[model samples]
Target: MTANREIDSILQRAADGGRITPEEALLLYTEAPFHALGEAADTVRRRRHPDGIVTYLIDRNINYTNVCVTACKFCAFFRAPKHKEGWSHPMEEILNRCGEAVDLGATQVMLQGGHHPDYGVEYYENLFSSVKQAYPQLAIHSIGPSEILHMAKVSGVSIEDAVLRIKAAGLDSIAGAGAEMLPDRPRKAIAPLKESGARWLEVMAVAHRNGLSSTATMMMGTGETHEERIEHIRMIRDVQDLAVERGYRDDAVETGQEIGGFRAFIPWTYQPENNHLKGRTQATTMEYLRFLAMSRLFFDNVSHLQASWLTTGKDVGQLSLHLGVDDLGSIMLEENVISSAGARHRSNLHELIWMIRTADRIPAQRDTLYKHLAVHYTPEDDPTDERVVSHFSSIAMPGGGAGRKQLPVVGVS
Candidate 1:
């Protein structure tokens, strides 16, 4: 069949509650009309989130260490093991950041960092225990499959054991980082030292089997083809389906819906600044919208589709709401890793309210667990007296202000 015919059929299947094969998905991604694609995806979004209101989370990302062993070429943040400026966040510093997040009304803290050589599961256990002890209200969402692989190897433990130990110490969920690319070719090109695609899925599968459902993410526009993009979605959907099947088998009394599955799927464009893939143009707004809409259509079982304003900018992020995204990721009281990679868009609480209202949707502040805390409708501008916060470099604190910023607290872009 022609690409157009294939896409139309696939879209019809999705609209009619039937699943499309991976090849059909690929064709739809390549040839589906933009308006039709958006409508189809929006239908799915409406089904999942019947309410017209979309949601965002109040959270912060705290990078625990910059010293990395798996130095990917696409990364601009990781420091070599022997680099003079290499460092890790001290326990006190981590605890302080969590406190700051809690003070700002953030209930989630993502403790992402490089794969440090010396750290073990014990390190995470102690850090998680301390964070939980300090702020029991905060959900400790940290680490990805890649970091898990490194930790498992370094600590001489199975992924299952590592997850159980971390959970015991209060790690709530995995962050799904290190997913630069899903296919082996692109994965090898960017982060060869990281675990293979299968291995990454294996670890996440273990986590899901152990009753911890986590979000999945895709990093796109890194010299991959449209077909490859569909494959990435297919891979995640396959895993999600497997997770559902596994859950049913694990418990005799528990129904599939009672067990944890893939909670959300987020796709963000690649940041092509100050990295080995320099000079390569990042994905365009149209491309991002296309991918976002396509992901919503293809991954029908995934609960939420997140718009990545942090990487795509405010206008594109807002536009994404119409293109079938049901959530705008987080407020991120603190976000450095992506900012360092050239995401210049900024937002405060006032701006976030204005954006959401202007788009004809209700803005809600939520916790990491998707529990709604507040629905914001006020359209007031930020107070002029609000102090400006620095962005790591200008932060003046203990440890001589190294890599600390003093940026203003704000909502997500």
Candidate 2:
């Protein structure tokens, strides 16, 4: 059979709700017609979600610490211990941030931070417990694999034990961070002291087995080849398969299904700003959208595909909703990690609803776990009632204060 015919057959099978092999996925990634692949993926997305109603989660990212040990080359946000600028937010301050998020209608708070030398399982337990105790309504969905590995060493606890303790402390779910590139060659080159690709998957598997569902992510366009990009997806797929297998064996959920597993797959491009890999090529908007669509097509087991509007701008993010992405990530009231890494794009709830409606998708406010809270068919349908008025202020950062203005809303051109 011709290569094109084989690719078509694979696409057909995937459309029919069947999983495609890695070889087939590679073909689609490499040779499948761009528009054809997009259309095929869109078909699958529409079938699963007939409304094409793209949604954005209501949450905020709170980077609790910038002091880090494993200084990955691609990171522009982390500061070494010796660096005077490196700092960690105290628990009170962190809780204050959570209170602010809750006030702004953020139901989930992403507690991201660098691997501080002194922080360990006890520190996280106290922090998570404190957050849960204060804001019982807010879900604590935070931490990446790198932090988990570092904390296990610092606390002198086994990986399984650390994860179990954290789960017990009220970690709602895990975020797939530090997955710069799943291929070992690039991963080792960037983050030498960090955990191996397999080890990262192992940490996540333990979390899944312990009844914690998390999202998977990939950081692309960071000097890795296109083939390596496909390999990243393949790696996540393999990890997800193993996670499901373990979850089923352990009966991680009461229903005995693959619950407490990977809930969504999110792929975003690398940001090169003040990092070591300066002057590196960044992922273009089209490349990002194409990859977003391919991700929806590739990760058959994953249900929700989230577009990183925080990394890519809102327009492409809006366009991505039609290209098979169902989630627009979070409406981050304040995000330092990515924004510090040169992601200048910003959005608020008003602008968020405008973007969603402009794309012809109903805007629904959702919680951390993707549970629907409210829907807005139009601005009139919005229930916020109290509009968040924009004002001028200055944000104090490690460098200096950058004045804030009203969030921009560029009309459709």
Candidate 3:
């Protein structure tokens, strides 16, 4: 058959809820009409989430340390272990930030940082336990597979033991940080000191086997090829398939526990400013959108696809709703890592709800587990909570907490 006919057939199969091969996904990503691809992805989104609600979370990303042993080339956020600026937040300081986040109505705190050489699993265990002891209501969605591997190595424990210890110490879930590119060539190019892509997946698998659910993320625009991008999703899908085969979902259903395996997939572009990679090549906005649509169409087992409005501006983020994204990510009370890498986009509780509403979807505040805690169906019924401001920590701004503005509620463009 001709290329046009083959592409059309693949699009139809994907739109009709049939799984497409990786090659088909790459073809769709490369050749499909932008609008057609988006429409098919939107169909999939609506079919998966019939509620017509776009979900978001109120969370704070607290970087506990800037000291890193693995100085990834693409990251502008880390400091060498012996650098003068390298510092770790004390336990009291971390608890204070958590207190501030809780006061600002954040339901989750994403605790991530560089791989500190001296810090082992015990550091995390104490931190997580203290946070949970003080704020039992707050969800501790912290760390990633890379951190697990690093800590496991530092503490001389197996990955399974490290994950189990932290989970028992009150780590609610893991974040998909450090998954810059899962393909070997691109991953080695960016994060040479980090664990291998296969090892990352292995650690995540161990976490899943131990009943910890986590989200997955991709950092695009780091000079990876189109084929490598598709390969990343394929790797995730293969692992997810194994989780299903192992009765992870069945165990959740039978025991009333939260489902094991990845809960969502979030893909964002790599910010190139102030980083060693230095913007030699980056994924364009169009490229980012295409990848987003392709991810929604391809990751059939993953239930949620979040738009990274924090990296992609609010305008594209608003447009992403129609292009197959069901979640707008988070109204981050504090974000240092991405902002340090020159991600300037910002949003508050009011602005996020308005953005989703203008996209012609109901806005809902979601917990870390993707559970809708509150849904705003109408503008008149929107929450009037003033503490829900954007950049509350203001770590990205100089002198901290200055120049933060109240975002006006505007109509959809």
Q: Cα lDDT of all candidates, in order? A: 0.75, 0.76, 0.86
The TM-score values for the models, in the order shown, are: 0.89, 0.91, 0.95
lDDT at residue 157 of model 1 (Cα atoms): 98
- Show the colliding residue pairs in model 3: none
Report the C-alpha lDDT of model 3 over 1-413, residue by residue, as the tens digit. Answer: 23488877877788778899999999999999898889889989999888899999988888899999999998888999899999998989888888888877889999988899998999999999999999999999999999998898999999999999999999998888878899999999998888888888888889888888888899989889999999999998888787777766523533576568888899998898888999888889999999899898898887889999888889999999998899998888778888888887766688889899988999998888877789898888788887676676667644346234344332334
Summed over model 1, clashes come to 10
How do all the candidates rank in terms of TM-score, highest first?
3, 2, 1
Looking at model 2, report the run of 10 residues with the lowest lDDT sum: 387-396
Per-residue lDDT of candidate 1, residues 145-212 (tens digit): 88877888889998899988998899887877877678899888888888888888888888887767
Question: Top model by TM-score, which number?
Answer: 3
Error in Å for residue 338 of model 1: 1.5
lDDT, candidate 3, at 145:
96
Off by over 4 Å in 2: 1-3, 246-258, 385-413
Kindly indicate the candidate among 1 and 2 with the higher TM-score.
2
Ranking by lDDT: 3, 2, 1
Q: Taking the tens digit of each residue's C-alpha lDDT, what string does model 2 give over 164-262?
A: 999899898899888878788888877887888878888888888877888888888777777788888888888778776665322233344644667
